[model samples]
Target: MSGLWDIRLEGSLETLSPFCVIAPGAEEVTRANGGKYRRISRRTLYRDGLRDSRPVVPGSTLRGRLRRSAVEVVRILSGERMPLAQWHQNAIGGIKGSDSEAAFDVQLRITLREKNPVLALFGAGSPWMTGRAAIGDAIPEGPVETDLIGGARSDDGRRDGMLFERLDADAAEQWHAMADANAARTRYKKAMRDLNATLRAARKGGGPEEVARLEAELADLVRCEEAAGLMSTNPVSMPLLHEAMPVGVRMRHRMMLTAVTEAEAGLFLAAMNHWMRSKPALGQHESLGYGLLRGEYDLWLSPAGAGDPFSVGQAQALPLGTMTAEPIAGLSGVPERLAGFMAAFREAFRSGAFDFRLASEIG
Candidate 1:
């Protein structure tokens, strides 16, 4: 109850299907034994004064669900060495990673589910901090004590929202950097595949002379990959792009305090897929869901030999260790009073926290 607050995220829903639930039905099938979602509709405004909170959802809740889904989807889609080419050979285009019409769209849906709500919450200045981050360092010593009867003041003179502001600022910076890098990798990989396909086609001329020419061309491609530093010994290779930290992007933020589980990620993915399949018109925004997944996949990496393919099943099967709560106070250097409030919420999350049901809005 100390951490609970009335926070609403502002974002659009690509789908209008009521049957489409963003969260899975069962707790065992999900991270928190349930999924969280805000029923976004087309009517949600980009910039309007105090829209109805009836359909709104909390950004933190959505983030938790989306983060879980993205990781699981990634494991299913790109975790294995299986290629779209192999699927093509079998004419089975419905598989997750297969380069079929739905593959990119499915991935995109996950990205949208993850990013839109987050962007909306931050852009609208929600009164919630990220799992990391804190208020500024302008407060007193130790954690601020909250009286059971008479509510005590935050460490800093300002309210709890100030802490949320600071945390969002820090998270925004890191989120952008990681996203840009992943985008770059996706683009570079596409280019390499196209170049290789062209060379392979040229080699089908079937003469010694043609074979020699194709081999020379192939050699050049190898050199190019080497020069780009995309040819790594690591099985899951990535380009060695020399990216300077984007201007205005801060990198000194503290690490995540709330560790998300894999079940949560899967539920998020299911919700996103349901949303995207129901609404195909909003393309690029939908694609950002996968980008968000690409951002958080590290949180729930599946162990080797958990299954034939590394996936959410692997992560879910891993014995859940003890959940720990850290002092969320000092990370962001925000006001002490504000820092404590932010920290407490995140600490609870680290210790497997959730909000209980209040009055239902359904008529």
Candidate 2:
């Protein structure tokens, strides 16, 4: 019971639409066409005694998607607007800086683990906790076919005098209002930047009175900006291009869960189930109908012995395909053992056995 439980999820992720996973600053701006195009993420791989680089869905992207979906599930289940103070600290991790206390407090760490299953499974950085879940890069089984998709935005019609003449007076007035709003937003951004710089300087060397004044000014500026509204206006036509993997491209994805309890596993699986049912889009251009994926996976469990933790015993296959009702409460057509785990998670959540406080509260 004290030993680790190794859970493996092997799946095929097939793209239902053109998918693009672009790393930041990875886009290529073409001068010839005055267009911006981003390629899908790629990594070097050895295949058939040859080294080649091809488009790949990064493991980090998959992990991020899963973490986001899991957090959303928790939010819906708990009915909290802001579940954790720092989602990064709870779902991902945060490093303790030199000024912070060392993560050597074993009792505190154990308490955090017992309180929050998410922190226990995903880990936190306040005490340098290690995550139990790991996802491998989704590698294409065959050649990945990619194509360029082009999109364009219509002009804002402000510069076209003829078009404005044909429009009604009210429409013309609305256009002017949009232009004014754009100018106001620009001014607000500049003022905010200047205030931020002054505040930083005050905090560093200026007197406390100056710092307080700057803070108050900053708060007032924020309120004004909110009242004025924050929306893009007077948008000009621009060409957008994306180099994406075409639909029906199948990639192999694997997720490994280490040292997870039955309840913890159930919670994680429930999140996955939610993600699958919701059909949440991944990667970029979700608004443009990109990044839709269909996942079909098989689950396996292995219990390690205390004498040799690394040694995995016979793995039991749990062939629960993508079919689940509620997050953890309505799992139907699953194994009795798996259902028990789901029941345990449901009871734990219902009884408030786990603390759902803001992550900042955790020492």
How does candidate 1 score on lDDT?
Answer: 0.30
Please give, for residues 18-127, the per-residue lDDT of candidate 1 as tens digits: 11112234122111312222222112333246542122122333343433333333334334543443322112112233334333344433333233222111111111
In candidate 2, which residue ranges exceed 4 Å CA deviation?
A: 1-4, 27-34, 83-88, 92-104, 156-235, 306-336, 358-363
Superposition TM-score, candidate 1 onto the true structure: 0.17
Per-candidate clashes, comma-separated: 26, 0
Best by lDDT: 2
Q: Write the per-residue lDDT of candidate 2 for residues 1-363, one digit (tens) a residue.
A: 134567777877777788889988774755453455766798777888998777878888877767766676777788877634456555666545564556367787777777777777777666567778888888888776678878766655755668877878788777767667767876786788789989999899999999999999999998887777754343344455679888888888888888777767777767766665674577888887887776666666666333354545532433444432332233345556566666777777888887746444755
Deviation in angstroms for 96 in model 2?
Answer: 5.5
Over 4 Å off in model 1, which ranges? 1-173, 206-363
TM-score of each: 0.17, 0.70
Query: How far is 276's C-alpha from truth in model 2 (Å)?
Result: 2.4
Q: Cα RMSD (Å) between model 2 and the true structure?
A: 11.5
